[model samples]
Target: MVLGAQTTEESGAIAVYHSDDLKSWEFTGVLEFDVTNAQPGLSPDLVPRGYMWECPNLISMLDHSDGRTYDVLVYCPQGLAQQDEHYVSSDQCGYIVGRLEGSTFHVTRGFTELDYGFEFYAPQLLSTGDDAITIGWMGLPAQDDNPTVDAEGWVHALTLPRRTTLHNGVLHQVPLFPLPDKPQTQGFGAVATATCEHDETLSLVDAATPRLSTWHAEGKLLIRRHLPTGDETRSVVCAPGEITAIADGCAVEVFSQSFALSVQIFEEWQNWTTETT
Candidate 1:
């Protein structure tokens, strides 16, 4: 078995290891990137440079659509800045789609965000039957001001398993199964569904110390929160249609057919109700 790991020391690059048995392993070599000088008007997102990479996951899959097999490398790069129109989180999880040849990955397409959500990181890919699915942690690193830590003394949860596919050089995600129709009210979590008319709004409000709200506006889905720390909001572009939101304590993951967005809620609201119109 071969494993990929992030090295904090040395060059802070990704290290590859090989093992004949599950117990013993040997260090192979580091993944190398070719660097080049860019013109003054070029955007930095076209370049890949980071201080350290974390949560390196490498998988080889056969794309039956084109009858070609490719290697996908997913990793979180720490301290990388975002430029241009790329929506990258502070600690972003991205993937490199390429070909693996004898311990080296030849880059076909550059890195891109695996998810545009704020709380998506440390994603793991699993294969079952003939499909590849992914699960990501719905928490941000170095952020520890959530109300759940004080009220329940817990901080994080895994996202619902999502089926992932590569289409037109982008990764698309969808729920593995249909979302539950029953209303859920367990602990600080809730699941709500809404079907929108043309340009309508769907609202979810949680009453108490940390209140949360989500709605679709313009061409984007927006999430706003009122936490003890402060008020904040995050959004992503999506087509107007049916939407579903799954809230867990201070974090909520919103899903649409095209994309997904996850945000943290932190304020207390007096009106504890949800409405869709």
Candidate 2:
């Protein structure tokens, strides 16, 4: 799979190709820019006359559990920013979602499923049939201008891959291995183990679960009663791994392994907030 900028005569464009038998090949045509339609959704006077697309990548996510399939693409657009320059500065860098129809591929999804924070760029994804793995270049045009990055040589690092699942029509993500291995303890010991009264607010110290607000305790993990606010922010806390907040009807379940902990979110309250030792 290939992704790149629609190029023009004055600039270079990135392209991709694949062959099964090495002797025959089939692929998407190159994406080069042209002055006529080079800049999407831009005024003619403000368009960057000549620019090239950088890296392009693609991954396929074909899962039977959810019964939906799609491919992901990542690429960079290299050109002068809003202000044109003789030398290339940079342009938008992010991932795009697409679908494959036999030998024809179409990109229909844009990068809205990204963190709104000021971090992450040049993101990429690799689909393993069950999951579409993602990573990104921490460094970007903004980072290059920052003083901290100038001294560090490396201005950024890829975030841990997250597994995305659509639950009740809303998308949720969990760090592949969301929970930490530490056990919630009591007294002056490790972070997870703590004590709290029945009706009180406590700051979470364990990094194993999401920040939680609850009426009870379970070792180091937190258990919270999810309240409805018609807001996406209303969620359970399951630190290090997945953020577990009770939605219209969802809660977290915990289980134990040798040295690590595993957590699962469920709609059934019966096993939602269990404390298995």
Clashes of each: 8, 17
Q: Against the true structure, whose lDDT is highest?
A: 1
Clash pairs, model 1 backbone: 208-268, 209-267, 209-268, 210-267, 211-267, 226-267, 227-266, 227-267
Give the per-residue lDDT digits (tens) of candidate 2, residues 1-277: 4645565574635566667887776675664322332222111131222366566666655434456665544455455444221121234443344464454445444332233222345656565565565555544554343322333343344544556543221233455544435543432122332343434344332235423343233332333332232211211122323222211111122211101111122222232222321
TM-score, each model? 0.74, 0.44
Model 1 agreement with the true structure over 44-117: per-residue lDDT tens digits: 34325566677878777655567566677788777776553343567777776666665666766677677666
Where is model 1 poorest over a 10-residue stretch in terms of lDDT? 34-43
For model 1, the stretches where C-alpha displacement exceeds 4 angstroms are: 1-12, 33-47, 62-67, 84-88, 181-189, 195-201, 206-220, 266-277
RMSD of each: 5.6, 14.8
What lDDT score goes with residue 200 in model 1?
61
Q: Model 2 residue 167 lDDT?
A: 24
- What's the lDDT for residue 60 in model 2? 59
The TM-score, computed over Cα atoms with residue i paired to residue i, of candidate 1 is 0.74
What are the lDDT scores of the predictions, listed in order? 0.64, 0.38
